[model samples]
Target: MEAELRDPIAAIGLDVEAVDLSVAGKRRMLRVAVDQDGGVTLDDVADATREVSRVLDESDVMGEQPYTLEVTSRGVDRPLTMPRHWRRNADRLVKITLVEGGEFSGRILTSTETTATLDVEGAEREVAHADVAKALVQIEFNRKRSLPEAEETEEDDA
Candidate 1:
């Protein structure tokens, strides 16, 4: 069931966050969560669900039984605790805790196979990707702040 959903999502250039299969009463339910670069839209979710359902119908991989299929996006409150999750959310602010018990708050600059670069206080620091004990998206204060008139004038001068 997982491979059935993953293959179509990958072919469509979407990321499959999770695939869950559960049996309810006599019916099997397949839930797939998908995401992409900015985010997943309602249309995108519907399209993916339709495509996956078509594939499943054609393949009859679920056997000769009735099942329900649902596809959706990951919720906003989802945690950025996994390396691939962090990598996908690059350039976003994050609070990272190291395995050695230290914590750093910074923007995720980049990530490689073994390391992640963080822009901390104007200085770029590289930490082992595995060393990130926990990482969560940081709330942005600027989103709530209005720019002062003076700041706007300075921008006009530039």
Candidate 2:
């Protein structure tokens, strides 16, 4: 279902970040989370809702079952499973649990299809995608880019 949604959502300049379906009593719940580079808007949700509804209605995909459709955008609390997910999360602080049981927390500096370069303390650490078992963005509040830190980042940028 999510695969079916990717193209339509991308056609509208949005990415389908997640899709979840579940049963709630007599009806089914179809939750679709969409996002983009700057972020998603209410207008985006409305448009996506219309598009999704239109596509679903035109096909027998749901199989005549009545389901509630919800289109939304939100922060995800799941593993960084795809290269796009890692790319989208660049510059965010994250806690990673590797498949080999090593755990670490760092800021995502950058990513490629196969690896992510993270800023661990003042140093850079690169990890392969296959080694990551779980990765979640960490909440940050009142973050300060102090002068020295700012300069250091600028140097790294060079």
Candidate 3:
């Protein structure tokens, strides 16, 4: 389904991030996660839904099975499993758990197909893809840029 829907989804400027098929009672649920460079919007999801439904309806792929199709954006809590995922998350803070039962958090500095360089408290560490069991980006909100403003405010108050 992914291969068949790739071209159609790409036509709408969306990329198929993942396809999940599960059994919901007697019916099947087909969840398709779509994403793009910046992000996916409601319009994008709507377009992808229509395109996927049309393609599936016109094809014999579903084989008369009635399934609920859900199109959604990539969730922030989604695990980072691929190099492209790491690349897209560059400069973002992430918590990684190793297959060997070790865990660490750092900001992603650079990434390649096999390794990622992270800034771990002013120190750099390189991690290999094979060593990571799970990785999730940490959400940062209203983070200020540097301490210059705070320092200047203190000087004025004095």
Candidate 1: residue 34 Cα off by (Å): 1.3
lDDT at position 137, candidate 3: 96
Name the lDDT value of residue 123 in candidate 3. 100
Best by TM-score: 2
Sequence-dependent TM-score of model 1: 0.69
TM-score of each: 0.69, 0.84, 0.79
- By lDDT, the better pick of 1 and 3 is 3
After superposition, candidate 2 runs with Cα above 4 Å error: 145-158
lDDT (0 to 1) per candidate: 0.81, 0.88, 0.91
Compare candidates 2 and 3 on TM-score and give the better one.
2
For candidate 2, report its TM-score: 0.84
Write candidate 1's Cα lDDT for 1-158 as tens digits. Answer: 67777778888878788888899789888888888877888889988988888888889778988888889887645666556676777888888888889898988888776777889999999988778788778767665546799998999999
Better of 2 and 3 by lDDT: 3
- Runs in model 1 deviating more than 4 A are 22-29, 59-67, 81-84, 141-158
Q: Model 3 misses residue 26 by how many Å? A: 3.1
